[model samples]
Target chain A: MRAIVIQAPHDIRVREVPDPTIQQPTDVVLRVLRSCVCGSDLWAYRGESARRPGQRIGHEFLGIVEEAGHEVNGFAPGDLVVVPFRWSDGTCAYCAEGLTTSCPQGGFWGSVGSDGGQGEAVRVPFADGTLVKLPSAAATDDRLLTALLALSDVLGTGHHAAVGAGVRPGSTVAVVGDGAVGLCGVMAAKRLGAGRIIALGRHSARTDIARTFGATDVVAERGDAALAAVRELTRGEGAHCVIEAVGTEQSMRTAIGVVRDGGAIGYVGVPHGSGTGLDLDAMFDRNITLRGGVAPVRAYIPELLPDVLDGTIDPSPVFDLTVGLDGVADGYKAMDERTALKVLIKP
Target chain B: MRAIVIQAPHDIRVREVPDPTIQQPTDVVLRVLRSCVCGSDLWAYRGESARRPGQRIGHEFLGIVEEAGHEVNGFAPGDLVVVPFRWSDGTCAYCAEGLTTSCPQGGFWGSVGSDGGQGEAVRVPFADGTLVKLPSAAATDDRLLTALLALSDVLGTGHHAAVGAGVRPGSTVAVVGDGAVGLCGVMAAKRLGAGRIIALGRHSARTDIARTFGATDVVAERGDAALAAVRELTRGEGAHCVIEAVGTEQSMRTAIGVVRDGGAIGYVGVPHGSGTGLDLDAMFDRNITLRGGVAPVRAYIPELLPDVLDGTIDPSPVFDLTVGLDGVADGYKAMDERTALKVLIKP
Candidate 1:
């Protein structure tokens, strides 16, 4: 099997590797159908995070079940499934709490076991918990397929940001990013019944896509202008909910400053270089509610999956580029430089 | 008329000042029956806050109407009243949102006015909004004096913490700090039907008072030990609500760290100095709901005043010392060094 391996900072190469096999009672082997490079993956690819030689990469994918361990009863050969980024035992206290990403017995899909979704074939752990079955009719539906594949990551994350930020019906929400995740957040806010959605994006193309995703308004401005515009749109009350999808301090402050007196700020941007630190006394005085982390994707996939299959929500418009596995390097470079909102990879 | 004035730090003098006359149509003059030194007032005396020159001190008071201006129509001469610590116009959007403390025209007594309640006479601005008319019997009952006086600030603040922190029937609450405000929080939590109230205090006397106010367990521990004790009591799930009454970084962190996931932190402490600037990313990951601000005392006074009159909840224990207007210096000294929980002054 051929796989992409990151040897060290700024060094990634495709090489032949041994195929993965089911190792645990809950394990199932997946022959990769489609995969994509994630924003987090770039952290290591760009030398922002350390990566060892020959390590398997990627946590997003949709695929066919190549084989199932004897104990894995629900899944069988040739079954279509979308695998979330994290694998967890569904019965653990944390998993039961809807925080499957932080389950004690769970681990990141790409880091712990045989392989990651970015490769030819990867072994999924706790298959019953990590894999969401796609209906046969929508299995080959490219638009639905892409959206379902995204449910493994960005789409679920966008929904988490909206819900955690307390976006509600009639709420005015300000989304603070232009990436695929931010685009999906506009959809999530719409699904949650937010009356008005403001998407802040610098790029014209991304701004247009945000509009298509249900953003009622788009602020091409950044920093104080963006904050001012949101406040103005809200009749100086600021937004009822603000979503931060960029991990910079400026973005965090923008999220905080643009929320109304008792509003919520939901942030999911993995801190790039520095982290998010807030003024305790100020937050205390402002009465703001902040909530968001790695998405509890598995918990929402059951409900979100049907919507994706039936075309109630199409989250894949954010994926502006698609290519064969051989062009994975170009996909990474395009995303790293902001040339593409997202890159979809096919086997 | 006699008034309590802080000539400087550590020097509070009761002296004759010009009798207060309404400067605005919304103002009303009151013949003060009683007033109490506040924990916050000690901040100026101890030089903890920026102090004004010859500042008129004292905020809590129960008094009688002496005169009313043209615009003040709610009461006539001789009606008893409980004046909130802050005066609000009542007609602003902020007030309509139930945030009277943050009302655009609202301001706390003693911080600016020269005739705050620790005097023979005082003037209340926006009297119609800040002054509530009770059945004269409930307002003048010496039996309900302390609790009614408490409704002006500390007791209402405690209720603010309980409601903001989301304590409910069968919920567990942890109160950090055992000052008068914190003790009142214990009482408020109990009234809100919290199943367990853990009061963290170092002083045995303070802890005893906390238990009397309905603390099921008194963790004489500060910092880490208090958090451990709270977690232990909640079967390792942590408290459902944490009321942070100490306005320091350590207390704020403890408040955020000790609550169970999805629990809330209601903080009311006016920030003493600089703080650790809360970690937004860490808090986002923890899934905690943080809500707090200055107490909207006027909003709670009506509900609490009746309880005080009926002798259902007693907050008078907070007024541990009594002083005549001439003894204002001693009141400051006693409260500053923790010699007294609160000092009441009879003009």
Candidate 2:
């Protein structure tokens, strides 16, 4: 089997690795049909997040179950399935509370000794609890397949941000960041009935997609300018809900600044660099709410799947570039260099 | 008129000040009947919060309307009323959204040239928006009046914390701080039908009040010990709702530590010292929510008034000491020395 591996800073490669097998009674082996390079993967690629010399990479995928353990009653071989970024036992207290990311028996796909999703075949733990079955007929549908692949992480994450922000019908939403997650957040807010969405990003191509994703307004500015533009768009009152998809201090500050008094900020961006220098005093004075974290994408997949299947939303546009397992390195490079919004991988 | 003034750090004086009159069309002159020294007042008394020499102090009061300006439509002379710490124009968008503290036209009592609540008479701006009417007959009932006075700040602030933390029926609530606000938080949690309430405080006197207010368990520990105790009380899962009534960095950390994954912290203590040293990384990883600020007490006064009137909750117990207007200095001294949980002032 071949999979993406993080060798060092700015170094990602498709290397031959041992094939994954069902090691636990609850585990199942998956033949990866589709996967992708995430903005978060860039953390390791840039050496921003530490990674071992030959560690497996990537955490998003959709696959067909090649083999199922005896304990996996919910799935069988040849069944199409979508995997959330993290695996969790559905019956755990946290999982029951819709916080699967905090499940005690859960773990990430590419942690220490696990199989990376960006490979030909990977082992999935807690199969019955982790994998959501996808329609077998959708495997041949490129558009639907890509959208379902997004459910593995990005789209679900965007939906989490929206839920955390308390987005409602007729709400004015402001989304920070123009990354794949941010674009999906625009779509998610729209799907949740947001009357208007303000996308703050300077990138033309991404902003165009944002508009198509239902962003009623676009603010191609940064810092105070962006805040001013958003405030101006919302008639100086700011948005009712702000989705923070960029996990930077400035982005967090902008999210805080552009949210209306008493409005909430749903931040799904993986915190980086000074870790969201949030000013408690300012937030208190404004009566603002800050919620969200590593999204419990597993809990959201079921609710969002029907929308993707019916084409109520087409998140596939986020994938402007596609590559095969052999070109995984190029996919990483493209995302790192900002040449692609997101890369779809055909394994 | 006489008023409590902060001459300097550790120097409180009852000084004769000019009598207040209707200043704005929306203003009303109130003959203060009851005012109280708050935990926040200690900030100015300790010189932690800078104040101008001889600045009038106090922001909680229940009084009789002495005079109403032409534009004061909701209130009239001789009407008994409770005033929130801040006065806001009810028609503002933020006020309409139930965030009276963020109203654009709102201003805090004792700010700059404004008359403080501890004064014999106060000129209240936005009278129609800031004051909640009290039944005239209860004015002579010391117990009822004391509880109603609490609705002016403490009780309402506690309710804001519970609401911000998303308190629901059957929630496990944890209150950090045993001050008047935290004690009131216990009562507020019970009012919201919380299944269990855990109070973290070291003072026996305050914790005793907490129990009567509905704390099912008391953890009289600090720092790590308190965290461990709370975790144990909730079966290592922590509380679903945490009320942070102490604004210190340590208190914020404890609130964060005792909150379960996907739980929220409603912090109402005016941030002092280094402010809430929030670790966004930890908060993000745990999916914890942080909300609440200077409470919009005016928005909650109505809902809580009926309960106070019926003796369903008696927040007046927070006032452990009482003083006349002439003994305002003694009231400040008692509270600053921690001999009093809260001081009631009669003018």
Candidate 3:
């Protein structure tokens, strides 16, 4: 089978790799129907995050179960499902409390835990907890699979940001990124009844798609100009909720500054790779609520899958391009080069 | 009329000043039945905050309405009333929003644009908004009057802290600072139905008082130790709500450290005179909600006054010492020296 491998910084290759087999009693082998490189993947690709040889990377995917281990009872071979990025036991105290990302027994698929998901075959542990079965569709239904693939990670992440920000009906929300995930955040804000959705994006194409995803306004101006624009629209009080989808010093500050006093600030962007500081002096006076670290993706996938099935929220607008395993290297390149909103990969 | 005047820092003198008279249609002249020195008063007495020559220096008082301006009909002559340290015009936008301290047209008494409350007689402007007329028995009840004197500031400030923190039934509250305000916070938490109240204080007397006011446990600990104590009681999740009463770096950090993930923090300690910083990095991961600055004490007095009237909560325990008008200097010295929890000045 073929897989996209990071050869080094700025060097990615689509190369042959052995297919995965179920390794644990609870594990299920997924024949990848669709997968995508996340925004975090670009960090290592751009040399910001350390890259190493023989390391498998991507974590977002939807697939047909090729095999299920003995202990996995809820899923069976050939079942269509969305595989959330994190594999969890689902019985840990943290997961029980809806903080799946912090679950002591749960671990991320691609990061310091098990194998990555961007391949022809990937083994998912604790299938009952991590995989959400979708209604079976024909193999030719690429669009539905691609959209469901989004719910596995980015869409769930966007909803996490919206929920953490405590967005409500007739509430104003500001989303601070133009990436596919941020576009999904716009969609999530819309689904959650946010009155005004402001997408802070520099790219014209991305902003247009963001509007389709429920962004009511576009803030092309970066940093202070963008925050001032948001505040101006909000009668100088700023938005009721702001999503920090870009994890940078500037973006974090914008998230804090653009939220109204007593408002909520939710961030889904990985602050791990970015050098950002939480200036409490700035946040304290405004009395803002700061929440969200990593998206508890698994917790959301179950609740959001129905919305996707019912056409309540189309998470597919994010898939700007599609590629095969052989084209996955170019997919990463296109996203890193800012030419694609997101590139869906089929194995 | 004899009054306490801070002619300069370290130079408080009980001197004969002109008798206060009603000067505005909404003003009322109060014959000061009781007054007290506050911890904030020491900021000027110790040369921390700016102090001007011949300026009267107290803001906490309970007195009888000796005379009322023609427009002041809510309280008749001889009606006993307790004052809110902050005098708001009641009709201002900020006042309507329940942020009387941030009232656009009102100013802090003794600082600028307002008269002082610490003397034999006081000319209280916006008397209708500032005065809380207790039920008739308060005129002869010394303890209730002294506690009502507390309602002018500390008691009101405590209610502000608890309400701002959103304390309710089953809320696990941690009260930082064991002063009169801190003790009042403990009582307010009980009144608000906090299942557990942890009082962080250094003094034995104050801790005992805290216990009396429904503090389930006392942390004779500061900062890290205090947070540890609070966590031990909370099954390692710290507190559901935190009230920050001390305006210092250490106390502020303690407040942040002692709250659970997604818990709320309310601060109202005048912000260490200038400002203070928060632990944004840890707070982001914890998903904490931070609220409070200068409390709108006026907005809270209306609801709290009745509780004091019916003796549902005894705010009187805060006054550990009492003195006559001539002993006002002694009152200031006792509070400054930490010899009294609070010193009630009788004029």
Candidate 4:
């Protein structure tokens, strides 16, 4: 089987790897149909996040179940399913509370000993708990399949940010970052009925997509200017909710600055860099709320899937580039060079 | 008129000061009936929080309206009232949003050029917004008055913490301080229908008050031991809601340690010292939320007043010492030396 591997910083390769097999009673083998490069992947590619040579690299995919163990009751061969970034046991206390990311028995894809999603086939543990079955027809519909693939990570993460920000029918939301997840956040806020959405991004192409995703306003400025622009648009009060999709310290600062006093910030970007923590004194004085982390996409998928299936939200637009399994390195390079919003791969 | 003044660290004096009068069209002058020494005050007393010599010091009090300005529509002379720690214009956007503490026109009592609650009279700005009218009968009921006084700060603060923590029916709550505010948090959690409440404190006396207020369990451990005890009590998942009323770095760390995955920490303690900010890495991985600050007591007064009036909760137990106008100095000393949980004053 061909799989993407991180050989070194700025070096991605598609190489022959041993095929995955069901190793446990609850395991199943998946033949991946779709996977993509994520904004988070850029961190390791940039040598910012440490990664060992030849480590598996992707964590988002939708696929057909190629094989199932005896205990895997919810899924069987030939069934299409979407996999969340992390796998959970579904019955743990955290999982029951809708925090599957914290499930004690769960682990992320692409970890040291695990199979990455950007591969021909991978072994999935806790089959019933880790995979969401997709409609049979989605296996052949490219557009719908792309949208369903988003359910595996970005769309659900965006929903998590919106939920964390307390987006409601009349909320004013400001999303910081123009990446795929941030664009998805705009869609999530709109789906949740946000009255106004302000997207902060400098790129015209990304901001154009943001407008299509339901951003009522776009602030192209950075730093103080961006803060000023958001405050001006919000009548000097700032937005009621802020979605922080970029984990950089500057992005977090912008989020803190643009959120109104007493408003909340929902931050889902994987934290990287130094001094990324909140300014406690400022947060305290303003009575602001900071919530969000690695999103529990598994918990959110059930709710967001219906909208996607019904065509109410088409998150497929986030994928601006596509590649074949052999071109996985090009997908990583395109995303790294900002030439693609998100790169989808067909295995 | 006489008022408590901060002469220096460890030095408090009740000295004759100019009597307060309605200074603006929105101001009301109140003749103090009851005021209390707060744990926050001990900061200035111990020279931790900077205070100028001769600065007025208290910010919790109930009184009779001695005079009202032409624009003070809701309050008049001879009316009994309870004052929030800060005065906010009732019509401000923040106040309308129920975040009165963030009102642009709001100001704290005891600030420079303002009369403190420990004085015989106070000139309250935004009379219609800052003061909640008390039943005329409360003036004579010492017990009810004490409970009402708690609404001026501690009780409302506790309610803020509970609300911030997302306390719901059947929640398991942990309160991380034994001060008046933390005890009130226990009561708040109970009032909100929390099924289990854990109070963390070392003092038997305060924990007893916490039990009376509604703490179903008490953990006297500190640091890792405290974290271990709370995790054990909650079946290794920690509490669903944690109220952090101690502003020290250690207390904040304990709060972070004792909250369950995807749980929230409501912190109302006035932040002091270095390294009091959140550990963002840990929070991000666990999906924890941090909220709460200087409470919007003015907005909460109306909701909590009815409970106090009907004796549903009595926060008076926190006031273990009483002092008269001339004995304000001793009140400060007793609170500073930890001889009293809270000290009530009559002026």
Candidate 5:
């Protein structure tokens, strides 16, 4: 089986790896149809995150069930499904609460001792719990397939940011990034009926997508200028909700600055490095509601799948570049060089 | 007129001061009837917060409106009122949104250039906005006076904590302090119909009052042990809500530790000192909702006053020590020595 592996910093390769086997009754084999390069992957690709030599990398994919374990139910071989970034036991208390990301028995794809998603095949644990089955019609719908694949991670994460920030009808939302997730956040806010959607980004191409994704305003500014622009747009009261999609100290600070009193910040950036601290005094005095973490993609996939299937939304545009399994390195390069919004890989 | 003044660290005195008079069209002179030592007062009393020599101290008080300015409405001389710790213009966007503590035109009492509450007479700005009028029956009711006084800060703050944490009829709440505000939080949780209340504190007297205030359980532990006890009590799922009343890193961490996935933490403690950073990675991964800040006492006073007046809750027990204006120094000393759970000063 050909799989994406990181041989070293900036060294992405596609190499033959042993095929995954069903080792447990709750496990099933998946024939990955699509995988993608994530902004988060840049952490390890750029040697910013710790990784062993030749480590399997990637955590988002859509596939067909090649084989099912004996205990798996409601799903079988030949079924198309969307795989969440994390696998969880559906019965855990956290999972029951729709926080499958925090499930006690949850495991992340490509994490230590776990299977990776960017491969020809994957051994999915808790198969029934982690895979959202797609209808047979999905097999022939290429456009819906791209949108469905997004439910595996980026789109679901953007939705989490919006929901966590309490975006609702008439809400004024500020998305503090223009990456694929940020653009999706703008789309999510618009879908949730936000009255005003502001996207803060520096790049022209990304901001253009942000506008297309329903951003009512785009500020190609940084630091105090961005904060001032949001405040001025919001009548100096700040936005009702701020979605922080960029995981950086500066981005979080900006989000905090542009949120109104009694408003909230839904941050979905995976924090990296140190000196990233919250201004507790400011957060407290402003009465800000800070809520966000990892997205429970599996929990949200079921709810979002119908919207995609019905063509209410098409997040497929986020994938600006596509390649074959052997071109995984080029996919990483396109994203790293800021030439591609996101890259999709075909197996 | 005589007033409580801070001459130096640990040095509190009753010194002769000029009589207060209505100074602005929106100002009114308040004849303070009752003031108290707050946990936050310790910060200034212990030299932790910057204070000028002979600075007016204290911010919580119940008073009689001695005189009303021409612009003041809904209040007049002889009317009893409860003054929130911070004064706010009722018409500000934040104030109108029920976030009075974050009002753009708000100012904290006892702060530089502001009138302090612990005095024989004090000029109050935004009298119509900051003062919650009490019924004539409160004048002769000493019992109700004590309960009403709590509404100025501790009780309202506790209510904010509970409400911030989303405590409801079936919620299991864990309060992380045993001071006045913490005890009030326990009481607020009970009033809000929390099914179970766990209090974390080390003092026997405070914990005893905690039980009396409606804590279902008390853990005289800190750090990991405290978290373990709460998790054990909740059958390993942790509480549905956690109220962090002590603004320390350890307390915040414990509150986060004992909160169930998808649960919330309502913190009200004035974050003092540094090195208090959030575990963003942990908070993000766990999907915890961290919402809190300075309590909007004015927003809650109207809702809670009826419960206190009708004897539904007796928060007066929290004021275990009482003193006259002349005994102001002793009041501070008793609280500083931890010999009194709370000090009530009759001016």
Candidate 6:
């Protein structure tokens, strides 16, 4: 099987790897139909994250069940499913609370001991806890495939930010970033009945997508200017909710600054950078809620799947480019150079 | 007139001072009947916070309105009132949202340019927004005065912690501290209908007060030991809500440590140390909510006052020591030594 592997910084390759087999009673094997590049992947690709030679990469995938372990229930071969970024045992206390991302038995894809998702086939641990089965009609709908693939990561993460910030009817939300995840955050806020959506980013192309995703206003400013613009839009009170999708210290601070006192800032970006400290002094005095970590994509997948299936939302626009598995390096380049919002790899 | 003045760390004195008079159209003069030394006041008393040689000190008070400014309405001479720690213009956007502590025109008592509450008379700015008037019968009700005084700071702050953490029916709450504010947190959790209340502190006397205030369990351990105890109580999942009343980094970390994933930590202790940073790495992955600052006492006073007056809650027990204005230094010493949970000063 051909899989994506990082040989070194700025070096991605598609090499033949052994096919995965079910190793545990609850494990299943999946034939990945589609996999996408995540923003976190860029950290390693740019030589920022700790990556060793020949490391398997990627965590987001839409796939078909190729084999199932004996303990797996409600799933069999040929079933289409959305695979969350992490695998978990469904019955743990954290899983029972719908926080699969924090499940004690959970482990990330493409890590030291686990098979990566950007491959022709991979072994999935805790199959019953990690996969959300889609209706049979999904197999025949090419137009819906990209959006379904997004459910594996970015879109669900955006939803997590919105819900974490307590977005509801009449909420004024400020989404800090215009990346694929940030654009999706705009859509999530709209779906949750946010009355005003402000997208903060400088790139015209990304901001355009943000508008399409239901952003009511776009502020192409940084630092104090961006904070001022959000305050201006919100009648000097700042947004009722802020969705932080960029995992930088400055992005988190901007999200905190533009949120009204007693409001919330929901952050979904994987934290990066050195010395990224939340200013407890400011957060304490403002009574602002800072909530959000990794998204529980498994928990959110079920609730959001029906909406995608019914054509109520199409998150496909986030994928600006698509390529064959052989073009995987260019896919990473396109995203790295900011020429594409996201790159989809058809395996 | 006389007022409590801090000449230096550990030096408290009641000295002759100029009588307070209205300085703004919205100001009102109040004859303070009672004032209390707060945990935060000890910070200044210990020379931790900025304090000047002749600075007026207390901020928690129950008083009788002796004079009203022309613009002040619904309050007049001889009306008893509960004065919050801060004052605000009732019409600001934050005030409208019930976040009076963050009101644009708000300022804390004893702060530069503001009169403190320990004086015989105080010129209260934003009288309509800062003072909650009690029924005239309050003057004759001796038993209710201490409880009413608690509404000014500690009790209201505890309530803020519980409410900020979103305490609700069936919520399992862990209170970190057993000071006056922490004991009050137990009561606040009870008032909010928390099913199981865990008080984390080592003092037997304070724990007794915590039990009386409705703590179902008391964990006297500190650091990781305390975390283990809380985990043991909640079936290894941690508590649904954690109220952090101690401002140290270790206390903050313990609160974060014991909170279940997707749970909240409501902190009200005034931050004292430099570089008190929340580990966003841990918080981001666990999806914990860190909220709380200064309590919006004015916003909460209305809802809590009736219960105190009706004998439904006896917050007076928290004030274990009583002193006259001349004994202000002893009041600070007693609390500093942990010999008294709190001290009430009769002006």
lDDT of 6 by residue, A68-153 (tens): 99999978999998899999899997898799999889999999878788889889999998899988678778779888998999
lDDT scores in order: 0.82, 0.91, 0.80, 0.92, 0.88, 0.88
- Residue A343 error, candidate 4, Å: 1.4
Q: Between which residue pairs do clashes occur in model 2?
A: none
For residues B107-222, what per-residue lDDT tens digits would candidate 1 score against the true structure? 87777654677889988888988898766776546657666788888999999899878999988999987899999999999999999999888888788989999999988776
Candidate number that wins on lDDT, 1 or 3: 1
Docking band of candidate 6 = medium
Give me candidate 5's interface root-mean-square deviation.
Answer: 2.2
Clash count per candidate: 0, 0, 0, 0, 1, 2
Global fold similarity of model 3 (TM-score): 0.85
Instruction: Name every residue pair that clashes in candidate 6.
Output: A284-B293, A293-B284
**Which regions of candidate 4 deviate over 4 angstroms?**
A273-277, B273-277
- C-alpha TM-score for every candidate: 0.92, 0.99, 0.85, 0.98, 0.98, 0.97
- Put down candidate 3 lDDT per residue, B205-302, tens digits, no spaces: 99999999999988887657777788889888888799988777777788888987767777777666213446555665555666665566777888
| lDDT for B83 (candidate 1) | 88
Tens digits of per-residue lDDT for model 2, A43-109: 8889988989989988999999999999999999999999999999998889998899999999987
DockQ each candidate and list the results. 0.42, 0.76, 0.26, 0.66, 0.70, 0.66
Q: Per-residue lDDT tens digits of candidate 5, residues A169-275?
A: 99999998788888889988988999999999989888888888899998888999999998999998899899999888888888888998889999888876311
Best of the two (2, 6) by lDDT: 2
lDDT for model 2 comes to: 0.91
Interface RMSD of 1: 3.1
lDDT of model 2 at residue A280? 72
* Pairs in steric clash, model 5: A293-B284
Model 2 Cα RMSD, Å?
1.1
Q: Deviation in angstroms for B251 in model 3?
A: 3.3
Q: Which ten residues in a row have the lowest lDDT in candidate 3 chain A?
A: A272-281
